[model samples]
Target: MKLIDTKNQLNDKEKHIGKVVGVDNATLTNIQLKAGEEIAEHDSKNEAIIIVRKGKVRFTVEGKPVEVTPEHILHMTPLEKHSLHAIDDTDLVLVQVKP
Candidate 1:
């Protein structure tokens, strides 16, 4: 009964790459990265699924290196330590579920 056009949410401000696009039962974030950009190490406060919308990214999850490409997805559990880097220009959607 709802529709979200993710493409319109893409935003390229000074030095930004992520934005909260929706929040209800779950939190949805639109994340984009220019080549060589990175999201420093952090912990997920809730369960999250990172959906690759375009390009590629290198994700270090719990110290394990993984490459996620378009159409691929990465899951993170609560308090999971992870980091992400764009090997190329990339766009992603992060949906986090509240516990």
Candidate 2:
């Protein structure tokens, strides 16, 4: 058995990215962004699920804006283009599963 305290992994960096876990078929990533920081448009080859732990973020998926908060979760299909801007200091966990 193992335990991971996600909050303890946060740092006061501009765009802090940390790996929580990686295995044969899945990977877990931690992403922390300061307000106004942005992640450039990109596409992932694997299926993805993004969980917002705190704060707010605006995700532009295929040219549409989607506001995400702690109460929301986002999922992306493989190779779906997307980009995000931090509306507030944000913490997100991304889980990707191999096909």
Candidate 3:
């Protein structure tokens, strides 16, 4: 069992996008992007959900472009190819569930 204050972790330092923070049965990742910053295309072996914490981002999911704002929650199934770009300064959290 584990409990964490993810916000506290954020306050400790600013992170680059797609940084894996913690992992057990799942992965906890912290993503922060400056305007024009991007994470290149990649596929995940596990299912993932990306929570937009601040600003806006562009997601390319399976070759489709998706605009994601702080109000949206993005889900990616296992083995899905995805990439991200910041439309503005952004903060996001990626939670990946592993098998």
Candidate 4:
């Protein structure tokens, strides 16, 4: 078995993005953003599931605003445009599955 560490160690002024795993038809990504940082609008070709592990963010999905917190999870279909702003220092895991 292989082991992967998915951890966020960013300081208050830092942000990070990285791939944690990729196997067959699926991929796992780790995204961490400091408060006020944003990811500009973009779309994925694969289906996506976003798990919020800590802090809060406001996601603009197709021009609509959705607030997400650590207690919430988000999903998107292929090619659905979305962007996000960190409402607080945040840690997120993105899982993408191919068709």
Candidate 5:
């Protein structure tokens, strides 16, 4: 069994927003976003589920912006463009389903 503590894994230095703690054969990564930071527009080859753990964020998927706050989750299919902004100091987890 593998267990991870999101708070500890996040390094506040390297990533101004948050750190990507990779696990499960790189199938999942957790990102911590500082207030006012953002994950610029981009796309992925694998499907991903974004789970908001702490604070809030604006998640733009396929050009549609959705507000995701703590306890909220959003899914994005492969090749779907998206972006995220930290409405507050946010903790996000990205679970990528590898092909």
Candidate 6:
């Protein structure tokens, strides 16, 4: 198993406001998000899970908005369009299953 510390991942300035911790089988991935930043709207044909680690985020699934906190885990089914915005400085782990 590959071990990763999401916080230790390098931030790519040209990319979005988050870093990819680990990816395998092109299915599962760990992501980290910063404050005032966002993961733009996108869609996938597989299910996904978002686990909040350190802060708040405004997450939208299929156009419905929901607030995700450290105590919450967000899950999305196949083909659902979704996006996330950091409400404050935050950290999140996104696990996506490929179709």
Q: For candidate 1, what is the lDDT?
A: 0.81
- Residue-level lDDT tens digits of model 3 in 1-99: 656444433345444644556667787787787778888999989999989888899999999999899889999999889988899878888898888
Stretches > 4 Å off in candidate 4: none
**What stretches of model 6 exceed 4 Å from their correct place?**
8-26
Candidate 6's error at 65, in angstroms? 0.7
lDDT of 4 by residue, 1-99 (tens): 998896776863488999999999999999999999999999999999999999999999999999988788899999999999999999999999988
> How big is the positional error of residue 72 in model 3, measured in Å on the Cα after superposition?
0.8
Error of 4 at 73 (Å): 1.1
Backbone clashes in model 3, listed as residue pairs: none
Give the TM-score (vs. native) of candidate 3. Answer: 0.80
| C-alpha root-mean-square deviation, each candidate | 2.3, 1.5, 3.2, 1.5, 3.0, 3.3
Deviation in Å, model 6, residue 74 alpha carbon: 0.7
Candidates' C-alpha lDDT: 0.81, 0.90, 0.81, 0.91, 0.76, 0.71
Candidate 2 regions off by >4 Å?
A: 8-11
TM-score of candidate 6 relative to the true fold = 0.73
Model 1 ranges off by over 4 Å: 8-15, 18-20
How far residue 10's Cα lies from its native spot in candidate 2, in Å, is 6.0
For model 6, how does the per-residue alpha-carbon lDDT over 3-64 read when each residue is reduced to its tens digit? Answer: 65555342554223344553554454555556777888998876888887777999888889
> Which tens-of-lDDT digit does each residue in 14-97 have in candidate 1?
224455665666888888777788999999788999998888999999999999998678988999899999988788888989
User: What TM-score, over all chains together, does every model reach?
Assistant: 0.84, 0.91, 0.80, 0.92, 0.80, 0.73
CA lDDT, candidate 1, residue 91: 80
lDDT minimum window of 10 residues, candidate 1: 8-17
Q: Please tell me which model should have the higher TM-score, number 3 or number 4.
A: 4
lDDT of 5 by residue, 1-99 (tens): 666655633354534333355555446667776778888899999888888888899988888999998767898899999988888877777788777
Backbone clash pairs in model 6 (N, Cα, C under 3 Å; residues 3+ apart or in different chains), count:
0
Candidate 6 at residue 86, lDDT? 82
